[model samples]
Target: MGPGETGLNYMQQLNQIVYPGIGKTTNDNDCFVKSRSIFFNGTTDFEQSIEEEMHRYQLIWENGYFLKTLKEISHILNGENYDWELDIDSKTKNTRSNYIKDAIITKFSKAPNFQNLLKEAYNKDLRNAITHTQYNLIQGGVVLTNIKGDNHQPFYGITFEKWEEIYSKAWFLLRYIFSGLKDIMELFMFHLRKKQSQVESPFSYQMVKNGSKHMHTILKEGTGGLFINEIALTISYISIFEI
Candidate 1:
């Protein structure tokens, strides 16, 4: 049964015992006794509540980290440059890691320290971890402890968690990039089609040979359509294919 349902059952039992004459059926007395003992146990019910809350707190913290990273990257992408540093205070030393920064930077931008891309990837991973981890925790999954070293830690698998974070970041960043890229490509194709329509022989070698026309079309018709179109063109030409 669900936690609320279980809690209700316990309350029912407590009621029967406290007011014996009110609902003193044999079944009711039995249920009341059983549920009262189960609910009062410090380990089972109380510990479960604490675990759920902790998992939720962790999820929130991770999401916060992701949002912060995205904002930082957005600032960098806006042409403001800054040093990308991964800070880990002693309190979070065990849980926090800097490897995420390297992976994000490598995946998103040509420059080794492309701050925007790095931030975006970081945010993406954070969101993913929070989402997936919460899902696992809600399903009654046990949090395994690290008994290897001096630190007696309780957490899930490190590699799996890290990988989940990394891939999630990559997936989200790539998705964001691709969406912009697709819009630009569509705009570019539109221009090409418009130019071809205006020409005398749209399929002729001369029409195909007009490089200046293509450039002019992009500049005039494709440049100012929408932010998505502009971003798409900028990323496609500058980042991906290098036009």
Candidate 2:
């Protein structure tokens, strides 16, 4: 559900226990017991935001994979067309890896990374540690420990505000990709159809010599919305990657 709806649901459940004559609770004591019961429903205890925290974690990796997939598709569509700024006499052999990096820098104006998302949700050093190692559940929240770092320092806990920022970014990025992928699909289909129309036999001579006249019809739907919220939300999530 959306954030507003989710907040409403949370309040409704809380009120169901807090308000009198709702469910099996009719007083403060009953309310407290019902709330605790729900907290431990089918389990020893239920921690809040754990599911959302995990979702944010998975999205960080998945977002990186998403960007990689976009580069691959661009390569398939346009081939290795990266514009290198090296001197003409420079003999650096061009490779797919170099081409992908160049293409992303040229098109997206940045290197592909998920580091910002992870760092937004957690302390940067703690994020690096958790990414490499494991985290444990604690009373208030998850504790990320590094034997080398935390042994000399204190553990870092992912903050609620940062988690919200990460989650906001995840939704923003997914929608951004959704809009872009749809536009690309339309462009690809137009090219495919144009190619098919050019294949003429005796039964079907060149009735449509040029596809330029139909270009508007083919790409009309691709003038999609570049929503402002997409950028605003995404900037908060990946601000670190701007460098």
Top model number, TM-score = 2
User: How displaced is residue 31 in candidate 2, in Å?
Assistant: 19
lDDT per residue as tens, model 1, 17-79: 223221112334243224434433336653454334333333323332333333334434445
The digit string of per-residue lDDT tens for model 2 on 1-243 reads 022332343444333322322112133534332443343322432333444335444433323334343443333333332121222112213433243235433444343354343234333343344455566544434456653344655666654334445555544454455456555556655754654454432121122323411111111123332222222222233322344
**Alpha-carbon deviation at 226 in model 2, angstroms:** 29
lDDT values of the candidates? 0.38, 0.38
